[model samples]
Target chain A: MKTSTLRPLGRRAGDLPVAMVFLLPAAVGFAVFYLWPTLRTMYLSFTEYSLLAPPEWIGVENYQKVFGDRLFWNSLQVTVEYVVINIGIQTVVALGMAVLMHRLTRSGLIRGVLLLPYLVANVVVALIWYTMLDAQLGIVNQALEWIGVDPVAFFGETSTAIPTIALVNVWRHVGYTALLIFAGLQAIPKTFYEAAQTDGASEIRMFWRITLPLLRPALALVLVLTIIGSFQIFDTVAVTTKGGPVNATRVIYYYIYEQAFQRFNFGYAAAVCVALFAILATLALMQLKLLRAGETDLD
Target chain B: MRRTTRLTAVATILSLALAGCGGGDDPAESGGGTAAAPTEISYWLWDSNQLPAYQACADAFHAANPAVTVKISQFGWADYWTGLTTNLVSGTAPDVFTNHLNYYPEFAGKQQIQPLDDFIAADGTRTDVYAPGLADLWVSADGKRYGLPKDFDTIAVFYNKKMLADAGVTEEQMKTLTWNPTDGGTYEDVIARLTVDENGKRGDEEGFDKSKVEVYGLGLDENNGAGVGQQMWSMYALSTGWQFTDKNPWGTSFKYDDPRFQETVAWWRGLIEKGYMPSLAIARSGTSVNDGFGAGRYALSTNGSWMINTYYGYDGVEVGTAPTPIGPSGKRATIYNGLADSIYAGSEHKDQAWQWVKYLASADCQKTVGDKAVVFPAIPEALTVAEQKFAAKGVDISAFTVQIHENTTSLYPITDHASDVSAVMSPAMDAVLSFEAEPSSLTKANEEVNALFQ
Candidate 1:
């Protein structure tokens, strides 16, 4: 290994100006579209406003109310349940597929088939899941009946609605996650596995000791993403159950939408959004620290 | 990558910091200020079902008022409200738009809609010329008319004639069917007899298989009509003297706690326990109510006159219409609701917009709209024309008009916080339908609804 140093790209005066000129259009577009809306939402959280009137500042009253509101608490509980279930299923399926694909096939067709669902739009996936899980009309329950099993109320009962929704989410996201992990697996040095084999290490033991330790960065990434995606879930619940069978599947983001858009409670919805932000931000920080790659000194 | 991200974040902050200073409320006098004799006005409506008829109306209006041009835009139901709210905030609202009673009160309160009393006086318009109680619905508590009578809707029972024949029920009995809150009167008997089991037994039989019902007697759909159940339980409750509120157009509180209302809900929900109605879970989603009805699963359905075309569109089915049954109060009741065209308060071409709305409410346009035989127009003469047109289509729409002519309609609830009230009640209503809560628990829901007004 040779000792190396990194150089800054923007050090030269002429280079900085040229680079900025090239980047201005995209940066300006992002600022106008994304940054402004985000700041506006943050500012609105401290105010009580309807679409018809100007915002009136109440200074954290909306936040206090949200913490105390029954619906807010219910939706938060629902979101936590969904996140746990979805992440659990997605991680397992992703890791399993990654390990299996790493050991077995390199077929382009198989890889393409695995990547198809991740590329399908959320609306199409939700529509397919809803149609397949429908209580009376679904093919899933029909197949169950053909196997001499009782029909299941997948989207109807409270005990099953959230899990059923989580499963659909997993089905859509697992392929992408597995592909990401598979990429990480490919990047791992082949020498480590060979060294483990020289030591008479079993495949399972080598995977546990060598593969898992080095896969931390990718796993952390998948975990953080799974958390964010789980919290942001809305369309499936909206189209499938509509938070129904007595609000069994009313996730936090869906609740925020109903309050802000449907009920026009912009301030309270913004408060809920802020709470969600704090959670996601803290999780991201924790994951970053835990998953930072170890560095070896150059000789 | 880190340096680039930092640069982008800094640029974003700078842009927002600059943009923040210029952001202000949308000013009202942006468009249509000084009309050079003739100006084009924008009109928006939610119903694509009525778009063509209104497009024709716009054409004729351009003919009558050659100086003025009207442009129409149609949006889906959900998108329409979202777009309208956004436009109202941005001061880009259409010069004229169709308004619902459910949303108009909030608009009127916020002064987003213009009061039309001055125009009404200038044009010498007679609100009485339209259907009774329709023009009154547009009058606010401040005694200003904000809308003109455009169209009215009433609920009636649509039945499958073949199903009735198989069940040995006659059309005459259906026409004169009466109901009572206690045990449901003769209506319950008819519904039970119409209900059939997989074992080929009627609901009235001793060994009827309630668990294996093949065909339900009633169609309980998810279309709650803003939770008041215009198509389902409105007739049941209204005929039992259970008004949604003490007064409308600005009622202070709801009366969901009323024992009469509770009894009506309980009786309606009992149909599910008897397997005469589909379970709430099954009815609330998955399939459209009309589709379920057409599939021979529902022998009868409480449907609005607006959906007559939707039902008749189903092939190989003999559709029949009958008036709602009479109740214990010695009167049959229907929820009388109407839609209207209202001019936006911020519109600069108020005069031109008024001219368009005036013509829309006049006999000329209303008659033409009625001749299309799509919906029941609000004007009496237009309704007459519509009745003849519907006869030409071989469907008797009189089942809907009878409620209006007999004056058996109680107005649907109209209040300032109608949206909030609906939010508080819908979940509770769902709970009640799902048997998660008792009907009497609506009193607690009433308290929550009343608290919003407080």
Candidate 2:
């Protein structure tokens, strides 16, 4: 009797159009704003469109030229360097901050203070940091001079421009990464710590074993997100270095922006955009797979 | 299964709520009317500094054409172009707008702005009344005018008087500083003497530490929109017999590979290396060089005629004006940049837009704008009035007008693919200025720039 009653409800009532009616708006919005534009961009990658003029079909030409362009190659190299440096710094800094917050603060005040920088707008933060790091008049250089060190051109020289911009990105995002990691730390039960204590494990040993193993999911999420953000680095570089001192800090996104808006080469810029999307998607998938393998090993 | 359905329902409701809320308020009414009604046209401009003057002109325009009403709107520089481009594609752009030479070439070629030759012929427009080359700058490569010339600009060297005097540099010496392609000539010597170290030593001194500069003798305008680095290097290179291109108005190739340009670039960058000027890092730092001059951090700055008010606005600083230095050709050179008004191709009120642009280029509107001495107008009759107004205000702008009067000005290089050309040239120029590469290294970059045009 229970099977017969449940079957009729599942077969008949489930076929109602109410749910479809409810979901129609969101489906329309998704198609209009996101999905259609993305597909159009991919299509435009195969054409020659100069913003104002109607698109002219030219298959594979933009892609071929973009691959051969020296500036595009430089921008790609700079982007990879930026992503690697950023992820490395973010791992150390975010993990350290999370550990500090988990051990020292109880009321979440410390986490709030740490996450404040992340909440500030990127353009505002860029302007603040740009002023603070001035060679002659900046507060950072002034402090260094007081300590008997020569001034460093953080954003001006080719050797330092990419790293400096990466560090700024690290500074902006590390706080939020730590907050997430702290939540992960909170999820690990206190009983594990007690058990480790009973085993006479040192605090450092307990941290390496119990704390790190439990926090893997959060750390993986943070790493993947930070890598994606670093690869799309645009606003801070636009405001600070303007991809300059000879394109040292010109990341892939800034290059796309210049090609699209400044040079009005919409088709070439679309090809670059598609290329970046492919790279980011591949990277994210690899990271997830590696983490999945790690999870299986732990199981 | 229940969670997914509930989440989908929530998203649906949220999206509907947002979509409904967004259009709750309509865009403010701009006074639309029927086709037979009085013609109402919109005019857009970017400069807040010149808004009041143009507003005065608009009032005069309304008085002259009682049946037409101009609705004026002003936007900040970046917002103006971005918004214009958006409106351009949507076919909702202003009927009349202020156009820039940097953008007008592309706009004309793409037919985003209409040619005014027919309107000019109908009005019997006298282009000869404007400044010598000012009216001609609006003529495209195909010899059709798209804009009516409004005003022009020239560069000059602005100095802090007390700082120069303290460094033992005279006003006469400031005016006479000359440059050569190789040695940097007397111009460099002046910069070195004015540059002081923290240890009270000069840049020319034997032990002066470049790592510890108290003040930079020369201040660079950071992130100049034009890659030519107008105030800093345009005069120096042009005066040394290096042309921007092989031809003018619509040249297909750039001459950045010319050795004269390369040599001048090297000497200019050498200032950063020798501690006579600030590093590219410092120059790119957020503060404007104008502010540095105001704070006594920069002894000298190469500024344009448009910034006279900005120099005078500085507190506790005595501003001094001087002509640009003589160069290898034994002549003083400056860029004679002009501004103009244009009609959008998509406008329904094309005839009304033409009338506004013509009035802006005429002696009537030009004389009113010039008599205020805020800017040098394009009309020649208005030039005298502008100069007298400057003299009356105790601000002598002869440093700027001298270029126009003496006819020693080179036109700003207008050509196809300006933005792409700027992209290649600016970074190469930045490398030279930062002391990372020699100026001759620009040869490769120049080749890349020429490839874009081809």
Candidate 3:
């Protein structure tokens, strides 16, 4: 009876062009900004476009050059290292914060204060960290001096530079990630905790048995988003180190930036962008499979 | 869910269409206009300090040629490169922009800049009217002039008078200091003795805890920016008889790998190792080397001549200037770098752009701009007026004039991939200064950088 009544309403609504009105702005934006440039970049990846001259078809030569270049490989390694280490640290730290926040009854003020770092722009965050970590007059070094420790070269030493940048990245995102996980934790039913406690489970046992299982969906979402965000890490490196201290901080995006703008090798840069996309796509697929396995484990 | 998906698709299409239409109307597209309208030429420069002088030149030019309009825009040095590169790639570059000799070759090689041979020929302006070797700075091997000489700057040693007096050294005594590679001439001896603390501890004094020093004798950062790295290295290396490149314009063989080059790096490093100079980590903490000197933390700093006005303004700090200390080669040299006005090859108002360039080169514009005493004119004849103007301000800029005559060399020509080489070498240079790596490792660093050239 309900279906019969709703069928004509749906048909009439479909005929009213409501969806077009709703989707028009986004469609225009995507087609004009994202879709066209993405398609153009894809096409140019296979050609020789030097900005001054018209593009010429060069097949897979740009891709070949990208693969052969040592700097490209180094950039890839740096990007992967940055993504894996940063995402790992961010997840552990954020999840720990989430767990702590979950236990606290006073949430609003603490959560708001904790999320302040996330609210700051990346450039501002980089600048703040840069000033704090400056070896000479920075407060960090001054503190070290007070403690009778010799000042260590943070950005000046290549060994410590990448890790310092990664740590800053983790610090910037941990608050936001923790907030997301905390929201996920909030959404879990209190009855499930009661049930676990009633069944002779301790607080630790309840978390492992009931809470974590139910939080799989949220975990999967955060994991995917964090990985994608980590892969696009350019702003921090650019503002903080400029991929320096002997190229220790140079990520794939910075490399692409150098090739296209600094070196005027647009075709090669496009090829690099395509390679990055492929890497991200593969990682996303693997994440999906892992999430599926996680779901099955919950069942 | 179905309705949301359809709505999103429609919105995406609409947005794409709008963006596409907007993209077509770029500055480069409007660059080509009919001869009927008054021609508008865009000018790009980075320094806000010189904007007034440039604008004054523009106003003087427009007074005579009322049909031309000059649009001037400013960018920070870093943003200037990023914007220029992006605009060049997108075919929307400004009509006329400032060019540096070190970064100009890449644009000239790519033909992104229009050669001004015909324009120079038609205008009948003699390049010799400019400073000696100024015209060659912007000319490629093919004899194509890519820019018009704007002004030249050379490095000078700026010293604090109070610090020198505290060490019982007079200005007359400083003039007698000579230099050689091994001992750094009289300049090094004086600097080592003059650089002291409350306890009478000098930089070369044994049992001096470098980490505990309250004041440094000299301060210089080792990062790869225009100031300390490029400018100081050019002065030091050139003084040591090092060439940025071999005879071939595109060659990289003559770079930092040479033993003499290593000696120069080592000597500079010794300043820190011996506690004569502040540690790189501390020196770089300030916004600039000049800032350290201005704050009274360092007795001496080396920088370009244009910063005299900056030093004069600092209270309680009387400043004096001299040429860089001579190297082992018994020769003192300063890097002579000049800026130029370049027209984008893609501009539509090419004819009008040449007129603006011509007017900037005229004696009247140079005189008016030089009278402001901000920048010395590229025109040699207009320099006397600039000298008088600066003298009236109680600043002795005669060091620049004397240095130009006594010890000046044109900066190395722009290399096609100079920025790339810089990107590669900067970190290595930083490593050496930070004491994390041996100065000799610069050889390996050079090889690694040269590999990028191929």
Candidate 4:
């Protein structure tokens, strides 16, 4: 009876015009802004476009060159390194904060304070951290000196640059990610924990068996958003390292930026962008499937 | 079937609506529409420091020519190029904009800039009015003039007067230091004596702590400087009689691997090894070298003449200038770079823009700019006036001016694929400076840079 009453509205001819009216504005926006530019980028990937002249179609020449480009591969590897460090720490810390928030105060003030760093602009955060991590004059180095520990060249050494950038970004994003998971925690019933307590199950066991399985949908969403966001890390790198101390922080997006803006190699840049798009799309889909984003333990 | 037809109609309507709203291009406003039509042309420059002088020129220009006016816009250094390039492609760039030697080659090759030969011929403008080689620097490989040189700069050593005195070094000694690639010569001696450790021991003294430096003798503004190293190493390498390319303006071959250049780089890096200069990591840790100099953390800094006001602006600091150290070639050198004005090819008011560019290159506008003492004007007479202005301010700027007088200036490397060259050389140079790779690695990087030309 429920399935009959909840029949898909698209199947009825009478409701079709109403649905079209609602979707028209959004469809127009999508076509003009998103879809058109994407199509153009895809087409430009196979052509030679320098913005000064009309695009000349070269038939996969750019893609062929990308295969041999050492810088492109370096950028990809550096970007992956940043992603692993950023996501690995950010997820676990965010999950822990979410649980703490759910079990404890649930205070809006604490939540607001947690979201403060995320509210600040990425460039601002990067610059502030950059100053605070200066090898000689930064406060962080000064503190380390006070404790008899040697100062680390946070963004200066090639070995430490990518990890430093990733950690700074993790600091900025963890708060927002925590809030997202906190909202997910609120949707789970308190009665489940109470019932588990009555069943003589430990709190940790209840969290593992009940909390995590139900939180899959939210976790999947956060992973997809943060992962996609992480892959597009350009502003922080651009502001701080500028992909230097020797291309150590030259992530893929920054490499694409250098090619397109610095070298004016638009076609090659487009090819790289297309490759990045494919990678991110594949990652997003894999996460959704592995986590069963739509299925709920409650059902 | 009916539902599908309705959906297709909705999609078509949305597509048409998007198409209708997308036409944002402006119609070309006709220039010289009517006699005395009051055509206002737009001009853009990157340096905010020079805005007041340029604005003064604009006011004078408007008074002289009632029918035309110039509106000036200033953007920060990096944003200026990004904005200019985007606007140039979109046909919305200013009528005229400041041009750099590094970028004008690409701009000229792409035909985004207008050739000024015909305009110069029609106006009978004197091309020889600017400093020697300055006018020629803006000519493209096709032998077309793209810009008119407006101002010039040369690098010099700016040092803290109190630090030099406290180190028992006289100003005369500072002015006449000599150097060699082998052991760094007296130049290294002065730097080492100037550097102080945490316990207040000088770098040249026994028991000096290289790890815990209180003050660096030399302040570095950038790491490897993307292979240009204008203020940092250019003076040293050029003093050794080394050039960046096979020839000036449009040289296809680079000489980054040349032993003379490599040895100069090695000596410069050796300062860091000996605790006289900041390490590559500390130098590039987001703090301006000038800040360190201002805070007494740096005793000496090499900078271009354009920063004279900036160094002087630091409170409670008595700054003094010195020519770069004489090298094995028995001569001191500074890199001579200049900025110019270029007209966009798509400008509707090309004639008016040419008038402005001509005026800017003329002694009239340059004299006004010179009197402000902001920059060394391209015109010889105006440059003299600028020197007098500096003299009136009690600042001895002869160290910079002497380069031109002695003909010891090397032109800033002007070549196509400059950005590509920098991209390859920057990391390679960084590796060498950071002690991760040897200086010989620059040879591979130079090959990569040359490969781009092919």
Candidate 5:
């Protein structure tokens, strides 16, 4: 009803200098930190550099090796497993909390309680969880023992290590994600829900039909961010697992770190990083497209 | 006029940002060629226990040469390597830093560290002053001296005296414990006898529940010390006459596949199966071996001499150290590794850095450092003083020193691609230790490690 003739907005010549003045710092920062490092990583992927010596260009040799690298494939698979577990659980839990907060209570105190875990540093969260979930000495195990359960090797087993790490990260990130969805929920006009209620629609039906469709953009953002964050998991694995119980939790970033810092194989590490970048970029595009992040049904 | 004012503000902001980028480049602080200009030499080390000792040396050095000042910086072990490597790449590494045998080869190979032979020869610095093999370990494959020996370490067994007494195992029994790959010998027996279950039954008892174990006799660290196993099973393997490689300080191929080594690993793994040792899961459960020992979970922990003070620091635990068990070769062996000081090749004050390095390796510094009783100095006299200081603290260090006195020490496995070798061997060794793979898997791992050299 509020439609108007649409036209592509163009930058005015008069505003260019003002915009540039505002954008200079950010542009400089992006160029120095992000763009330059990305370009350098791409270039280093083709060379054999050990940090100590100058890089030696070797064409596609490093990439070729990466193709046949079993470790790379394993890391990618492990990272995918972590992402699936992390994103699936984190999304559902966050959505539930968001809905609960949106419908029941919108208190800032409750939201702050939800966001508290996210406020803690990743390293601190990891270390505290590592202590709590320890197989022998942790309080979690002691509690489990009291309830007739055998002690679980949370971070030590091949099957449980990545899931344990995923769950730990989920605990840390769920609150922030819930807050994001809660914000989206706030943006959803209450009139739509009120109308649906008057038309004899159940709460679940209205949620499925109206709320989900409207929540696409926020979900898409959460997915893309979390998927990327989950893939680059190094701190938890570094402190807890160190890619062990026989490479069970050797995520891509940890592999890259080991190659670059530990082994001094900077070129190989860079090549792996490029491959990770490609995978993440492709996944992000697919997610955005599938979610239709740009188009909201609000109009 | 308004537009010009806005442009001026923008220019000011841009200039400030650009100025911030250039703040790291301070050539003036790097010192000058002329001795008349006061020179500041930056030194770095990883050990915090040795910080006060080195700081004292810095004070003395400053007193001796008023024009030259030594500034010391300390970082934690893991951060030290990360910072050092990053700084080396960025051409901002300290002028002189403590170097490890694990990294010195790689640094020397890349020519990132300055060869100290020229300075040593020019100053007639006595390389032979250090304990046997300490000074020699710094000589690279190209026969260039890259560092000056500072301190040395050896492996020994730190045991809980209360646990030993409760298990009825005497200190003499611990000292004379012998091990063989075929049966695990007296060492295994002692470990089994010491291991206690939740029901208070020893591992050797008929109904001792392995699943309900309260205390493991032998403690294991996370990995097999990245295949070197310096503080884990290296002594056991070395005592069996199984050298890590054909030659150390530069070995082209590793001999991890050797039957002697494989059997040593197998026998060590058997301790896990028999419940004498904690499984890899419990060991790597984020509780360190020393912490586990202090908590009464581990009766004995094989550790390095560097951790001597740490083991002693555990409260409410009567700690004592014993020599490693003699193996099939009838010799009790320990891996002898020493730390040294090396100058960065890109250092601005090479002359001052060399002078600082010289002073750090001298008797003046070594004696002061040894007097702290924190570590064993490389110099024999300083080491003797350290031993005396340690004795004054009621710590019997003969368990660590007997290897040096008897010449039953093997050098740390120094090879190129040390981390690459670790990458291949750590998982393989972990698999074997974790009971996920067989010891024969190490043969394949050894092949892979050797392939790196090829």
Candidate 6:
């Protein structure tokens, strides 16, 4: 028995080499690409570099400029407003669709129809919305005229532009979010619902107590993803307004792009990037804590 | 504990894999191998339609010089600037590229563009071969010439002949029309009368609703940059004895707060207020004002001669070109915007790049390109060929050529922060046009912009 145990231990030790061989390429890739760049960006943020000259050590100057910039503050406000509004609306709309689709017998057709918008590229969505929202010749305004409502410049006005963009963002992603929630709904066993029904619980109570409680994990995942996606919003704003009508819709990423590419101010842009990463990391950690709290309460 | 360790290892590997996929190959090291092989020169340009003509010119140069090879690349105008600037900063810019006068200063200040003085001296090419006061415009403040003159453009009035006929107006009537700050000459009155409603009512008629009008006599888009909008307004402002700067070339302060400037803005704005022009909302929708004119949605639209080819291609539209309407300052003025071919200072093959640039500025290449009516070549001798080409195309473009000869002014001096200044000016001007602010408020905008320049 001792000889057999020793031989099995030797074989287990040999398996470690194979496992490392499988992981070596990926490990090397991550070290060279993501980790190195993140560290490099962090170092660069403390310097003054314009890509033309060698970087000069100017600790905290770049960071100070970022904080002092009114544009940066405006962009951050816009980003947060976009994230909160987008996440709230998208989550509710997605959940409603998922729940509705879950109860349907013909779920395949409904799910396929819902997945269509998610498959369309963001630029295409922007173009479609631009055409539809055009003030004079657009179908939306034309239809509004028929109803005796004055033509509204959906993108031209500062007040309506950001929300309109947010609405479009929510419209594009709702279907995908709903699909994720639908899968979570399916994974929850039917036996729980049956038991709840036998307890003579109302439909509303069953939904609140049974369905929502089980969906906590999926909800947490979707919420985190939506927030992250909303934070990085660039393409739609670029294609639609170009952050115009007096910079009403300028978001953080576009601001970063304008600095780095337009002004060729790489060091300042890198500082902004670092700050963005820190903010994202903090939000992610908070999400993890909230998720853990939810899990403990559920238990 | 064993499961947690395995998960950590997996996550670490995944993150490492992501990290490895980041930063591109250094361009400097990649192109070194081919650098010595046959002196391959790269040419960067933006216009797709003009690429064929450029390619033909490149072929001519190659035939003349068998040792050197030219490679041409095309990008959209915006991408061209972004890519050129990015590469310039990275020290891997193209050997030669088209440079706009407006953007030349920014690159020149950064030492991104090479001074072509030595090349011009070596070739013994006379600067007088080009238009007067044109060739010297590209020289930096340090007295270093940076680029070769390629083409020149001036703004003019493009009108629909059929629309004029429908309104009982003749081409002769348009030729005599003049303008002032307070009164927009006979042109404004004609525009007011020609602008029609669904019930065949004009802007000047009683019971004619400005909001409900079906057609506009004039089309103007406020969304355009100074390259277009400011050029149009300058015609009025200059005629009203307003100067964009204290001097024609390089004065420091803008004269927008001047009474003449205010009158010019008010006159342009009154077109919208009187319903002679489309509302700011409608004019901005769909295509630009040029497109609106092509679609026959407006009787007249103001544009530069560079877009003549674009306008001529439209069906059922009888196009006529005229000089800008005379303003109260007793002058019909046009802003002359030109383009040039500049050599990259950082280029390894400076000799070959200069050779190509000199060839472009030569009369042979200019005649070949300009004779096709593609553009008005900067070489003065090529003007005859260009005019003939336009006449061959069944339109006399001489109106613009004549306007430039008599009333041309160089675009505002190449400020170091020119793009930034324009960035501020464009939106501020838009705000004024949108009726959200007054023209005088531009002083505040100018102050903010001047602060940025400082």
How do these models rank on lDDT, best leading? 5, 4, 1, 2, 6, 3
Q: What is the lDDT of residue B274 in candidate 3?
A: 71
Higher-TM-score candidate of 4 and 5: 5
What digit string (tens of lDDT, one per residue) describes model 6 on residues B2-46?
233223334533443332222123223332324776778888887
Task: Return the top candidate by TM-score.
Answer: 5
DockQ, every prediction:
0.22, 0.33, 0.31, 0.32, 0.33, 0.20
Q: What is the lDDT of residue A252 in candidate 4?
A: 99
Per-residue lDDT of model 5, residues B1-454, tens digit only? 2233223334533443343333234322332223347988788887878999999999999999998988777666666787788888878888899999999889999999999888888988899999998999999999999999999999999999999999999999999999999898998899999999999999998999998889999988754487899999899999988899888879998998999999999999898888888888877765567766766788999999999997887667789999999989999999999999999998888988999999999988999999999999999898889999999998999999998888899999888888888888888888898888999989899999999999
Task: Estimate the lDDT of model 6.
Answer: 0.75
Tens-digit per-residue lDDT, A55-131, candidate 4: 99999999999989988999999999999999999999999999988988869999999899998767667777876
Better of 1 and 6 by DockQ: 1
lDDT of each: 0.82, 0.81, 0.74, 0.86, 0.87, 0.75
Per-residue lDDT of A140-230 in model 1, one digit per residue for the tens? Answer: 7668878977556677666788998899889998988899889878877888889989999998998898878788777777788777878
Question: Candidate 2 at A183: error in angstroms?
Answer: 2.9
Could you give candidate 3's per-residue lDDT for residues A1-299 as a string of tens digits? Answer: 87667686768778669878889999999999999998999998998877656788999999888889988999999888888789899998998888788865556888898899888767666656665675655558779989988766576556777777788889888999999998888878788778877888887887788767877788888998889988899877765577765667789999898777776678889999999888899988898787863453333
What are the chain B TM-scores of all models?
0.91, 0.91, 0.88, 0.92, 0.92, 0.89
Of 1 and 4, the candidate ranking higher by lDDT: 4
- Clashing residue pairs in candidate 1, if any? none
The CA lDDT at B302 in model 5 is 95
What's the count of clashing pairs in each model shown?
A: 0, 0, 26, 0, 0, 8
Chain A TM-score vs. truth, each candidate: 0.91, 0.91, 0.92, 0.95, 0.95, 0.91
Can you write out model 2's per-residue Cα lDDT over A111-200, one digit (the tens) per residue? Answer: 788888898777666666776676655668779999999887677667887888788878888989888888878878888889989999
What ranges in model 6 sit over 4 Å off? A1-33, A105-110, A146-148, A197-206, A291-299, B1-33, B222-232, B246-251, B279-286
Better of 2 and 6 by TM-score: 2
